[model samples]
Target: MLTGQQYKDSLKDGRKVYFQGELIEDLETVPALAAPLNEVASGYDKYFNADPDAINPVTMAPMSAADLRDRIPVITEMDLLTNTTYQSLMTLSVAAARLEAHVPEVVPRIRAYVEQARKDDIRITECITDAKGNRSLAPSKQEDPDSYVRVVERRPDGVVIRGAKLHISAAAFGHDLMVMPTKAMKPGEEDYSIAACIPANSPGVHMTNTTYHPTGRDPRDFPVSSHRSIPDSMVIFDDVFVPAERIFLDGQTAHAAVFAHSLGLWERLGGVSFMVEQADELVGLASLIAEANGTAKISHVREKIDEMMIHATLLRAGLEAALAHANSTPEGYFYPDDMYTNVTKYQGASQFNTMVKHLHDIAGGAVVTAPSMLDFDNPELRPYLEKYMSTGSTVSGEYRTKLFHAIRDTTADSFGGWHFVTNLQSGGGLFAQRLVTRKNYDLERARALALKAAGLSGA
Candidate 1:
């Protein structure tokens, strides 16, 4: 496995990456990209630095059944969530193994790419969403064929692809990309049914980055945003050639559908795993700010806290339920209960706005109008600001300001706004989650129960 510095140095390859209309010559040199790059690198470091007992024998990395079984925090405390990056690698690894059980035509090649990824210890960002020009139309029916990423040229040795993939997180930082069909393909949409692993800096591959972090803020003021920011990108493939061995599924529509199903299961479970931590942090912050404001004893304040706690608790339960009911594929990869995973993700996304509302209620206006960290540092304003900001006598004025700033950065500011949207849209959004839930729900059992209750014959 590569060291953190080795991972950082790997991005020096001449990939065409653009940010805010300007070309980025090197990712490590860019401030906005560097944080997430470092974040990804830390995963490699964890594997290299971990004690032998922490390692998972199957993946040859430092994650465990307990780490996942316990549903440990992934967002709030960076040090504790040791297997965050390995989870992504494992998702695709298990995906390849699972796909092998059903799609024999493509499994061999897919397995080859999976083996290479494991052997090289490649850090991969899964790229599934294509830039569809029109939502109402299918890929083949779109006004432009480029709406969906497709193979334009099939060569004896490889295939050439041209199109764009959007909302690919950590695309510019990772070593490799695992491309899959965004959705199931129809009979005529064979060209869009391609899944392959391409080097991030492969020739003709370009990326334009998007981030939520505001520039030039004191790290103390925008603590969360300033410290770690993961940027998404629109990865364009302009006649990029992919070797035959790297291609997983080429013009296989039936298999492509299975890939989407399997990818969603793994991706949603991963999202659910990480988001439980976000909920935990939010709950803690809400309770902390309420106490800092000296309103913890108020009945209404307690009720609001209860609401947030309920959301957090229910989410945790759903995650555990999914894990407890995990199903193993014939290939030996265990997947979370599909219904439970989708329900957990949907519940989390649907309640995000309400959760933020509860947070805003508990935090009050202080979340938005809190004095800047710079103001607190000013010699003249320090005492005055402290006097006005101070609450709950025991809570230091500076500490109160920091808590409010944390609230603002995470719940009310632009960075917080990004979190809101990301929560809703991440892991394929509410509609997708609902669709999966509906598909997996046990409707027949419900129908029989209802019929028996109505004094009708149970069919």
Candidate 2:
């Protein structure tokens, strides 16, 4: 297994990585990316340190029937799912199915990819979303056919691809890029149906990263934001070559949508898992902030906290139900129950804004207006700031303001904005989930039950 430093060293391979207008030569040395890089390293550590019972001792894969299952819960019930580990696992599952949907000749490619990834402990970023120049036109109909990643040249030994995938999480930090089509294609649009795995450092594969990083803040002031974040990037493929062994889908237009469909389900499951963690954090914050503000007994505060509990409870129930009824696909990969996963994601996302608003309302304007820790360190202003910042007699001004700063970092800052938008839009938004729920639900059974209740079963 690759150690944290070993994983970091592997990124030195000559791939072009740019952030904030400057090309980054080495990720390990960059201060701006340090936190996110550490997060990725920790994910590697988890795989190495995972208990043998929960993971395969020899292969380092999860022991669950759902291959690549998020093992955060398996190791310690306390750890939250890390993006790199969970997402790489999700991509593995998705890539496995892409080949399973293809002809028998293409099936061995996915098995080989999985074996290599597990053997090397490679991190992967699933690259799906294309630049998609025009919304109304399909890939072949668009003025720019290169809007989506496609096969530009086909050689006997390999295929050359060119395009860009946007908002790819951890693309720069990962070892492999699981390239897949974002949308389905028609019979004539075979070029857009391509799916393959390319080494992140492969020639012509470039990554330009963009992410929210809170700078120059004491860890006490921005606890969560100061650590544990992943960088999202636009991964550009400029005539990158994929060997025959790495190509899962070439021109199979009929099965083009399989990658997206499979990944969507797995991604939503990841969303649900993370929401459980978020809900727990939000609840703890609400309780502590309420106590610190001396509003613990207020009826409205009590009601809002109860509402938060309801959201958390229902989402957790959905996750459990999904696991209880998880279904296995033809490829032998297990996915959470579709209806339950969709409802969990949709409701959790729908409630996110409200949860933030409630935390802000309970904590008051201090969440946004809290003075920087720098002022607290000023010898002259420290005394005066401390005197005015305290709320209850027992609450220290430093502690109170620090809590408020943490709140701002979570709910009022750029990081908070990212959390809100990603939570709602990450799994294709609420409407997409609703569509899945409607399609998967047993509506006919419900109608039959209703007819029986109304004494019209025979009619």
For lDDT, the strongest prediction is: 2
| Cα RMSD, each candidate | 3.1, 3.2
Writing each residue's lDDT as its tens digit, candidate 2 over 1-459 gives 766787778878888899887888888666657777776676566667544324323233333445434543543231122344444455556556555634667767776777667666667777888999988888988788889899999999999999999988878887788888888888998888888888888989889877767666676667777785667899999999999998878898988887788777567766788887788788888988898888989999989998888888988899888887877665555667889989889989988999988898899998988888888989999988888987758988888888888788887887888899888888677888999989988999999999999999998
| Cα lDDT over the full model 2 | 0.78
State the lDDT of candidate 1 residue by residue for 1-459, as single tens digits.
567788678778888888888889877677787767777678667656344234323243223345445333442344212232344555555556666666666666665666666666666777888998999999999999999999999999999999999998878776777788898898988889998889989999989889877667788988888867888889999999999888878897876766666666456766787678788888999899898999999998899889989999999999999888877655455667888988998898889789889888988898888889899889999999889888847988899889988988887888888888888898788888888778878898898889999898645
Model 2: residues with Cα > 4 Å off, grouped in runs: 49-102, 330-333, 449-459
Q: Which ranges of candidate 1 are over 4 A from the true structure?
A: 49-105, 457-459
Clashing pairs in 1: none
Clashing pairs in 2: none
Model 2 residue 374 CA deviation (Å) reads 1.8
lDDT of each: 0.77, 0.78
